[model samples]
Target: MAIGPSAVERWLDLSTEELRAQVKQLVAARLPGDHSVWQAIRRHPALVPRIRGVLSGLAASAAGSKDEAMQKVWISKARSALDQEYVAPVKAARKPVVKEEPVPEPEPVIELKEPEPQQKQPHKAIPTMLFQEPS
Candidate 1:
């Protein structure tokens, strides 16, 4: 349905939070204590504009009537619009984290060796005897 000029002006004038507050107020007024629709809207809040559109359509069609039946109808329409506009896709669950085991340290090594013995030589004294015999 085409949005009215006043609706466009109202939407442009209000902040996002204000618009949401207005939607929440309307939902609360129509369906008091019903939180499923509001919870869905809170989770995927981008659907606020769609909910506003549905509300505006209801207002335009009803022309400022405060009838209980009509308000119930508006609430029903708003819930359905929220459901259709913000259906979330199924997401995969996250995996658990794993811890690694600590490694053991190596042992120190040591070695020992014995020293070697030295050899001795003997001297000859026959030079004096040879000289005396020659004399």
Candidate 2:
């Protein structure tokens, strides 16, 4: 239920001399990224080291505090501000074009031949009707 200053408010509260000292400490620690406090640094995101130093100092002070949960909340907010600061945006990626190849047609494997139909011959008449009677 404790209310406190925001990260921007805390940063803005620092005296010029204190900010300069923090920036120097960051440089001494060989922290990467921009340490300058200029507005231009906000656009391209180069001021990480400077603010990170401030966060470190804040953590040291909060370590001995009675309210550990509140201190963690404050630190989380400050970190969130650092992470969400102005920076160069990522560009959309484009898909690469793929070339198509022509496929060859396959030849037939098995061959079959069919026989032609033949006409049927007529049957010869029998001579049974010409038999002579024995009188």
* Local distance difference test values of all predictions, in order: 0.54, 0.51
Instruction: Write the residue-wise lDDT of candidate 2 on 23-119 in tens digits.
Output: 3333234322333332233443434566666666666766867975665565565555456556555797997887878787798787676766777
The TM-score between candidate 1 and the true structure equals 0.27
lDDT of 1 by residue, 74-105 (tens): 67756664555334557989988778788786
Worst 10 residues of 1 by lDDT: 1-10
TM-score of each: 0.27, 0.33
Candidate 2: which pairs clash? 34-46
Name the top TM-score candidate: 2
List the lowest-lDDT window of 10 residues for candidate 2. Answer: 1-10
RMSD of each: 25.1, 21.5
